[model samples]
Target: MRDKVVAFVPIKLNSQRLPHKNILPFGDHSLSWYIFKNLLNVAGIDEIYVFCSDEIIMNYIPEGVKFLQRDSYLDGDMVQGHEIYQSFVNLVDGDIYLLAHTTSPFLTSKSIENALLNMLSGKYDSALSVQQKQTFIWYDGKPLNYDSSNIPRTQDIMPIYMETSGFYMFKKEHLLTYGRRIGFNPYFQKLNDIEAIDIDTREDYEFALKILETNKQIPIC
Candidate 1:
């Protein structure tokens, strides 16, 4: 039997960086509408659910998508992100889980479907969306991904993989065993800067709006 792919979006009303970030209006719908709708269009996803604490979120979701009311305590200010994720995985039963976020509105369904197909192929234990960057990066006051002594052209340098909260495809057993979305062997799904956009602040939201306004390739609702 094929593994069941369950895609879910876990959201909370509290947002210190961008107030009500998930529900903020984007085009004709809320910010989260795009991801949810995008998932619905994917053929690989067996089920789609919005795991949230508030019932008001239902207003933002489209028809056919299900809602799973999560425990309010999971949204506590002191609670860690992993704790909340573990709780949801424990509650819902599925062979595989696709952890998606509302902030990543530009992640195309083609990329998502391709990642899901890879997971179904059984070659990879998990998969994550990442943006490849060849720009200079520093960590702990030291150059990373490139040697400073022999600085090379940006395009010639080895690219760095930065994780995006856009989506994570993992087997249920892998998550239950390691308590992490990325497994021992993870497939890095490459995404361009536009597709990897994660709206965390007001500025990011504005930038996304600008993209939608100018990027005719992106579907508008």
Candidate 2:
């Protein structure tokens, strides 16, 4: 039997960096609408739910998507992300879960489909979207992805895979057992810079809007 995939977008109405960013206007619909619509179009998603505490979010979402009323306490500023994940996984039943966020407005269905397909293939236990950047990276005041002694060109440096807040594909059981979205055996789904844009701050949101404005023909979802 094929595994059942349940995709969800967790929305918190009160955003600290950019207040009400999730419901902010993005093209014809709100910010969350893009990922919601994209998930709806993905072929293998058994169900799509908007896990949020606010019912007002209904107005922003498109039809055919169900809603789940989450506890408002999960929206607390001190709440750790894993707590919310655990809460949702315990509430919803599915063999696999596609965790997406409204901040990832440019996350395309193609990237989501590819990641879902890879997870279904059984070659890997989990998958998450990432962007490859070949730049000088420093951690703890030391070069992380390169050797300062060698001083190689940027292109010559090994590419660092940066995790994007776009989406995560993982087994439900694994999350329940390990309390992790990224399983031990995982696949990194590469996405272009534009497609991986996540709107966290005002600058990020403005940048995303600029991208859409620059290309009028670009698909909002």
Candidate 3:
């Protein structure tokens, strides 16, 4: 039998960088509206869990979506994403879990389904969105991917993949048993820079708007 795919979106009212960001107006829909709408369009997703605490944001949640009331303790500024996941593992059931966020406002449904397909393929126990940055890299004030004495073409440099946190999918047992989001072997799904942009600062939010306008393919789910 095939495994079921459940998506969990952890939301809170207080945002350190942008207060009430999850509910912030973005075009005709709020920040999370896009993700919610897109996920609804995804046939691969068995369920979409809107894990939230703020009632104000509930208004943004569309009809027929599953609402998971988050504990007030997990809504604090210091609470980590993994901490929230710990709370979810005790509640939800699925062979594969898709954990995403409103911060990734432009996360494409195609990407979401693709990630789910990758997870179901069993190539890796887990999968998440990432961006390929094939640029100059460095660490601890030392050249990381290139040599100071001998320079190589940009194409010759090994590309570095950065976790975009746009979306993630993992086997339910992988998380519940190991207490980690990903298993020993994980698949990194590469996403384009524009599609993988994460909303962290004010500028990032604005950038997402531009992307949304340029690409009309993103529909309201």
Where does candidate 2 have its weakest 10-residue lDDT segment?
212-221
**Residues 1-221 of candidate 2: C-alpha lDDT, one tens digit per residue:** 99999998888998898999999988878888888888888999999999899899999999989999999999998998888888888898999999999898778898899989998999999999999999999989899998889999888998999999799988887888888899988999999988888889999989999998887634534
For model 1, what is the C-alpha lDDT against the true structure? 0.88
- Flag regions of model 3 displaced more than 4 Å: 213-221
Q: How close to the true structure is residue 25 of candidate 1, measured as C-alpha lDDT? A: 88
In terms of TM-score, the best-performing candidate is 2
Model 2 whole-model lDDT (C-alpha atoms): 0.89
What is the per-residue lDDT of model 1 for residues 1-221, given as tens digits with 9 covering 90 to 100?
Answer: 88888999998989778999999988878898889888988987888999899989989978878999999998787888778778888888899899999999889888888888887888998999998888999999999889999999988988899998899988888778878788888888999989999999999999999998888446522
CA lDDT scores, all candidates in order: 0.88, 0.89, 0.81
Ranking by lDDT: 2, 1, 3
Candidate 3 lDDT at 66 equals 86
Q: lDDT (0-100) at residue 194 of candidate 1? A: 90
Full candidate order by TM-score, most accurate first: 2, 1, 3
Candidate 2 vs. true structure, TM-score:
0.95
lDDT of each residue in 62-120, candidate 3, tens digit only: 76678888898998888878889978867887788888888887678888777777767
Q: List the residue pairs that clash in candidate 3.
A: 37-221
